[model samples]
Target chain A: MLQVFPDLKGRYGDFGGKYVPETLMGPLQELEEALDQAMADPAFLEEYHHVLKEYAGRPTSLSYADKLTGHLGGAKIYLKREDLNHTGAHKLNNAIGQALLAKRMGKEKIIAETGAGQHGVASATVAAKFGLQCIVFMGEEDIRRQELNVFRMKLLGAEVVSVSSGNGTLKDATNEAIRYWVANCEDHFYLIGSVVGPHPYPRMVRDFQRIIGDESKRQFLEVEKELPDRIFACVGGGSNAMGIFYPFLGDTSELIGVEAAGKGMDTPEHAATLSKGTPGVIHGSMTYLMQDENGQITEPYSISAGLDYPGIGPEHAHLFQTKQVRYEAITDKEALDALKLLTQMEGIIPAIESAHALAQAFKEAPQMSQNETILINLSGRGDKDMATLMEHFQEEV
Target chain B: MLTKTSFQGKLTKTEDLFIPFIVAGDPSPELTIQFALRLQEEGADVLELGVPYSDPLADGPTIQRAAQRALKSGMSLRKAIELVPKLREHGLEIPVVIFTYYNPVLQIGHEEFFQLLGENGVEGLLIPDLPFEESEEIRNRSEEKGIEFISLVAPNSDQRIKQIAEHAKGFLYCVSSLGVTGERKEMSAEALAFIEKVRQYSQVPVAVGFGISTNDHVQLVRNHADGVIIGSKIIRLIEAEIENIEKGRMDEALKHFTKEIRALVQ
Candidate 1:
């Protein structure tokens, strides 16, 4: 219910703060100040919106899932179609905003990190459009898994550097990206992909992404004439979830964040940070982190490459602690099953990351009455996930 | 137990201070104590002992490899802090500073961590990630245990250098370059003027670190700053001798290590 949180030091209930090296302090402060000034300027906001509407296709449709609703025989389901946005995912929303800021700040080079490479592709697209050099860091393992997305980033003229440390996943890529930023922050801008990292990052990323919920709210109100009973969004560093859930926080809708259960939460192989993680620091912020008793970060596993992270966003940590939002875990099989169901039933292929939230909605939709409504943020298109899906369904086909 | 008062006060103020860093258990904690003694004998005024962590963000590739080796030997913040008493017993009496990332300390809990420092002979504490803004509680907690909490000022910390240096306890840890800890061919030429700015604000001694790789870097920084803290170079030197130390050739490694550090500092 709290609208204004994350006090001046960027502490979202003592969760988010700048835990970076001394070298990054001044730069972070400058970023915060610059972002604040930019957000306050009407010209900046106008330009950001102009790019979003004309280029990336803003007001992404909120379509009624009639077949899904009839299949469930309970709640009427609606999909917030972020998957239709430019770059084929919601990642472009934040990238466009941050890239504009980079150009405004006179930064010529942009550095980014990715897991499924959606964010990398988005950053690369914006950098190419804006005529700035782009460098993207991705885990070696991810590069192998998300080959199409990796190639797409390169096709956009971004250099894709493979990181091989710490399970060679998003966490490792983020570490390499931050290290590079620390070294070259004087000339480069770090275009973060999610609602994670230190201070102004989580805040600015959330603001840039809040457009999802804003558009959904308007569209839903126009159609249903009332807010949905429940909102579902997958939590991978919580960018899409934060984007869709933030505008509805003050509303009566119940917010649910679904995390990747990987094999299962019972097993060590899962990226269920909000469910199993404890309070600790990772990637320059104090949040719910999957780490051992000795404070060593443990590797997380998930079928969804985007969701395979050891830590959740600091805002999600705050929301979880405050009990304003409920957090749940969906296993890999359930996500796959839901993806298949959505593809077959509606001819809409959702990204495996978004399928986690889809699975959650499917499970709970049967419980609510038909008059009640459920809105799911279909965060990305599943085209990039074909490689991963084929590997899973090869024998079946 | 070694009496704890101040590395800030006890170390020689007349000459430029030489500080060498090594992971607590690269092979074993026993070797770390021996290494500490060797560094002390080789004119190390302060010993900055590190704890192996899974993700060390500020460290470059060289120290990361050393940390991985140390972690394989089960080195932790508790083990790193507890090693101080062993060093004292082995007749290695110098100002011991625990250099670690914040998560390990968070795992130990702040109260227990400070108590451990008090119980051991740790005179100084440095968490590179805890910048000036987020370190008030830690600074106060360290002061409660009489451990001087070191503050770091980087080349980019334009106006904040004064605010940070004003509260600095033992010595201001001046970053010699604009990046993570590594061995670089050339030091940032602006580092000289940066140290001068820090000196103007800091009441305590200024120790420059992060890529003090070559002897030229050491000499250049030594003339301008009160102390020179060497991390990646020492890790690199010890890494070269890891095979010899693992083979039970401690004396040979110690002699080689001392000669190597002696060249840089002297």
Candidate 2:
């Protein structure tokens, strides 16, 4: 069988390349080689799966959302319960994989950048488990908003560094992380949190997280005796969406990625990268970026901190360009409404990030026939998003 | 007027080249031109003008701040490249290399960008983010335009330094340390050894850049490399003189800073 992506040059159809500084070139090459070797090694794969099974709770449930389906009153809906994973998010899948790779490479330290602090907490948790020193770069604003996750990261023995530059958000935090990685490439492994950044990272992260789609595909077939008609997931830097979508590529099932439309896309406040962004380079890879005409990156706004990024993963950009995946934007209000509805009906309070997917699914599910099924990747739990939810639903709370 | 020479030609004439970096359009573009001339007058052999970018992954806090200021002042890559013609028109004749990240150049089409640089009298280019592996297209097009595409080699480059040094044009940029561009208290001991390793591979002149700020840095790098490139400290100086430059006393502040470094390099 032919490989789907990441050609010899690490290009995902001219979108992904090693567009990093000279200091990181050798290290990235080393990592690419190591990843290739590790993937082919049966021992490495066995260890990775063993750890996932025993430590991170592999093969998370795929629950049929009967009430959500009834409420929509159109199509059957199923939730791939990545929220049940360790660290309460799908982020740990990639983090644990990378931490294992770091250990195999004899790297003793690992670093990561986080937006809502889910990835940070996940990285810290894996680091603590693997006995590697962890450092997480988070924006000052995010640290303020996700204080509980920050404290959780600290409690897991990871150092949290607050980035104050740019909009003091995810984009700046990523920049600082890359800067730190370039400087300290000799001793540290940058366990990037998303399916973004330079070449091998996007490929490697997707490979690690593709277990979600693989398991979902097997589970959905076992229950429905067929693939779901549609799959919905939110896109920040697109790790979770890519995870669930990669295995289903080329299949008859439709893939839809929902982006956060903050207040509204009309108000210039949103993180709808695929919907609104143009092809430009940011972080490291050439992808669809939220930048001005002069190529300066613009600050993205989303009530969901995890979705507040100005760029999407290059593979997602390629997928969007090729029309393999349908991209849509859901307003903050729509996501919140979906969040409340899901909580009331199913007691599944999702992270605001995943609520974007829920919101989109809620809209589309009602239009389909009852026999048609829609699978939504519930990417994370809502515990970290309680503060934002409480503020938005103060009257209800 | 300072003679317009290729970067390669300049290396033969000077024992030690002192290149000062300034972010174009910092505070304002007019001050940038003034500072460029001041550096030329203060014995800068080549000028590295940074085109402000929103995300400068290779830059530390000081250069990052300068880029932010420049970007806030409306400095786009087009505007920064347009400054090169302005420098030529004003009789500033040093070989000006526009130091930029690759995204801006990619945004402006590689052919059009190199065409603009050549047309604007730019002689060399330095993109810190475009490493040897990803630089083939841009580097080839730049050389075809008669513009030198500079390559950087880091201390941790290991055996890859040979491949980089062999294809390096104009001069090889030797990163003094592993980190982003910033002033260091002292140069790392591996810097000289790295430059020496680079010397074994290519005949091109080697200019050490990151963390080279003060006279002590200049003195240390001057003995091992053909050039010393100061970035963050000069940006820091320009930042300090922002108030003075705004009041039209730009020369007093800029001249003082450049002259001190110029005297040490000389």
Candidate 3:
């Protein structure tokens, strides 16, 4: 009887409404209906879980960071290994779910927008598996920064469209993808990569990604016999964090969302939406967005291309407003240091985006007692970020 | 107070109401006023002025470029709202509709936004992003302020067309196509059927927009709709005449283009 999120109007408190064009309203409504029916259908749920388990590798391990924990010399740290999932990140969870929903709806084409190419790769992977046509809109700047993942998307037989508008980042890619969907909504299902966008998308993405937390809850309980004291995840559009945080919403665990504080929050550069942004609508949702006084969205910066978005998810905005989640900013330098530390101490090279969570955990882990544990969602592997890492650590690597 | 009757008065016995849309502050704020006056002089039935936004999801490349130009010229919601008063002061008597995305209106609270539009002599408002479901509060406030809150009915909006049309003020903005605002080669048969369907429930005047350009488009749209709104093509015309306007020709090219369309629709 108690609903955790998105009431009938698709709102999480005052945030998250369907603020899209009139054309998209029908498609979104159709999607909402189909998703509701699919979620309730047992066979559909079975098929979704089956694909997630047999194909995408669900129940990713929760590994103890013994060396890193020892180096920190305080709280024991554990990693939820979403980085080990097929396609090397947590993005596949939502992609697979949406693709399945698309197939059930009898749609044969899928469209998506990606900033770091992780979502694009995941969408492309699912499309390939399902034998559907896939088109990915990526910012030109993101395409240049994330070349390997771009290639990966293409290799998986998805058309990668280079968007060159409005700073050519995630926001622009999303705009392009939405535009493409508006024109071609008859046969295409828009596979949104994050827990942002209009109503059902944020809720649906959270639903799909919640498996991370569900598995983590089970795995942690089986291993440690209790919940961790804290959970940390990096927030771009807040998909991975929302995925890992949803199942623990009612739990006593302290949820911390780490945003990319590029350069610093004080400077003009950063993607710390909850920390610095004001509530405004962007990409079909009213959320905390980095915008000017005139309500024009401002460009956000981060060394991690995946974490370079200017808006936080509407649910995260609600969470921040309600004090359900504490958000912190991690600078590029801090995230890089944490990435290097994890690679050296634990032999796990995390994606730069996921390293943001590690950065926050490293800071907090040192302050607590060793008996207290902190769980960090390692949302992706570092292979896609190798070029960025090499560029940053040119002499060292 | 301005109402749908005020707009109906502009349409002659033999003419389809011609509504022209332009991004406010496209070349400059000064040029925006000049264009508004020129459009009225060129027999525009109604004027739709767009307040530029950073993310206009419902707009296509041409309009997007125009918005970028307007933003580059320092256009903001406040400035765009201020332009309405200036148009009234300039003795432009046509009903001016503020065409914008929803965020700016939400940023400035609904009461204040409608009040601002009312104070500035703005007769109507069109938010492409604000669908019928999310428009109640704003629509109510706009009605209280006596500003016609225009509703858009898209091709994809199936049964909701009746609901939207029942409450549509000023006019029902019938989106001629499925995508963002742009010029198209030909109007789809589905769009013609969509307009016919919307007409079944539309008590207010039905004005079709999006991809409506050229004499052929105007001629085709006039057969089924009460009015035709032109946006991207007008922006393109302004863009084409930008060099001339900068050289002190004073939007002669745009004025000529508007005059030509006025003649075609008539």
Candidate 4:
């Protein structure tokens, strides 16, 4: 089912496709061809895996949350520790893989758009390592929010361009990046951060990130000798969620994706695109997106910069529509509370993006039997979110 | 529904074509028709009326600002298409093409959207994001409705130029630069070669756009292309006169606008 899904046109059901300017069609075709040849090459695959293990620190452990599970008092909880990766997120896996693809294609310059700055840092890290010129497009709002990551990216020799259009967020940054890529596509490679863009991108990024599920599935089977009852991961552009959910897709384990309900699903502020959104085209993919009656994309709000996107990945939209995965939304307050709970109980500071999934797991875990287990992808660390965290939890702290 | 001559037919009658693009309802709805008429009077063989969108990928800052003002004036794809008959009623005789992104069309769907273009006085439709490979459904529907769905070919479209030009309907759009819709100080040599390359395979007329601004830029492209499209520069001119247009001084503003337009094209 997974093999034949995207098909030739890159549609996951009625979702992803190459809806870009004519200037990009040639570049996109060139990229698709290069990626195909690179993926088929054993040497390329070996280098990607080798870098993941040696540099990015792959095989992130699946740790049993005994204390948190005891406090929740229902379902056993286990975390796939992606926060332990070198760049402190699952984003490096795709970044390293794509940067290697850029090198293989003989492209010297790479450009990317980042929301929470995780992908920016990862892309900058890989560029510095490979001696390639790196330019990362970030929203002015995000740069103000994630100051440390911005500094880290610059320290790693990446040029960060601040995009000030349309509420100054991930959507605007992506637009600027694509705009730049369209002009400079002859020499530069656009390293898309998530699984949301045009065809082959969603597929290629997912294949790079699928290692999360592959490792967790084997490790979980080793420890418990049985598959977990459910898997929970946060969905921004749904990259990390898709990563952890892809392997368990055909399994009996229930796969649930959590979206950022900034204020609430009833309000216009939430980023729960699949919940309240209609099917529309954004960033070249036809997916569930927050848009107006005239089909103009609306600004999405969320406490977590990573999950503030107005659209979900097309594959997630397909999985959502097909009922292959259940989607739930967590409010900013709920995620904050869950973040505090994990920090106090398990001594782990989870990224606010991942806390959306954690909060959902806590809700469902308490309703389930004690033998049932929940596996959540701790997608990133909370270090970059220090300023936002301090601002939100000032009184409590 | 209004039936009219195609933009390609205009190319046959006149050797040199100048298509001026302006965002519909830039400052106000009434002014849009007036501005379009002014361009029509200034030897504009075709007028491309842009449906103002919140996210316009191919547009530069100048045009993006125009779209912002247009959207603020309650302009939409539906509203822009509806504005075409009004332009005709106000005596806009030249061919009019609606330039829009793909999302609004996806929202309106193909069947009704094409029908709207036919019902209105629209002759051509150009969606920048819908390239040749993804334009199959749209191109087919436009053919059935007799609406020319214009094809766009860029400098990078080296080997793929043949495929895009094979079924080119009205005129093959030759992007004059590797960038988005904006003005440029100078056009590149590769762009000239690309225009010549597209001419080899194209059956219809060839129009060059995207940075075809300034007299030097226009003159250089004029030698290699059949038509030259100017977008951002015209928008920039109108934007500079937003105050006078709003003060009901349309005549005074348009006189100055015409002089500037003539300075570049003539």
Chain B TM-score for each model?
A: 0.91, 0.89, 0.88, 0.91
Cα-based lDDT for every prediction:
0.90, 0.87, 0.88, 0.89
- Work out the TM-score per prediction: 0.97, 0.95, 0.96, 0.96
What C-alpha lDDT, on a 0 to 100 scale, does residue B216 get in candidate 3? Answer: 73
Candidate 2: clashing pairs of residues: none
Segments of candidate 3 deviating more than 4 angstroms: A1-3, B1-4, B7-15, B178-189, B251-255, B258-266
**lDDT (Cα, tens digit) per residue for candidate 1, span B78-109:** 98998889889999878888999999899999
lDDT of 3 by residue, B1-266 (tens): 11345442543322377789999999899888878787777668889999999999999999999999999999988889888888878788888889889888878877788778877878888898999889888888887777878888888789788899888877778886532235654456777778778888877778888876567777777777788888987888778888888788865766675676566555
Expressed as tens digits, the lDDT of each residue in A1-397 for candidate 1 is 3659678889889699999998888789888888999999999999999999999998799989999899989999999999999999999999999999999999999999999899999999999999999999999999988888888999999999999887788999999999999999989999999999999899999999999999999999999999999999999899999999999997899999999999998999999999999999999999999999899999999999889999989999999999989999999999999998999899999999999999999999999998999999999999998977888877875
Give the per-residue lDDT of model 3 (tens digit) for A114-165: 9999999999999999999999999999998888888899999999999999
**Ranking by TM-score, best first?**
1, 4, 3, 2
C-alpha lDDT (0 to 100) for residue B187 of candidate 3 = 54
Point out the higher-scoring one by lDDT: 1 or 2. Answer: 1
Q: Pick the candidate with the highest lDDT.
A: 1
Q: Global lDDT for candidate 4?
A: 0.89
Q: How would you encode candidate 2's per-residue C-alpha lDDT over A180-280 as one tens digit per residue?
A: 99888888999999999998999999999999999999999999999999999999999999999999999999999999999998989999998998887
Candidate 3 Cα lDDT to native: 0.88
List of clashing residue pairs for candidate 3: none
- lDDT of candidate 4 at residue B178, scale 0 to 100: 33
Write down the DockQ of candidate 2. 0.74
RMSD in angstroms, candidate 2?
A: 2.9
Pairs that clash in candidate 1:
none
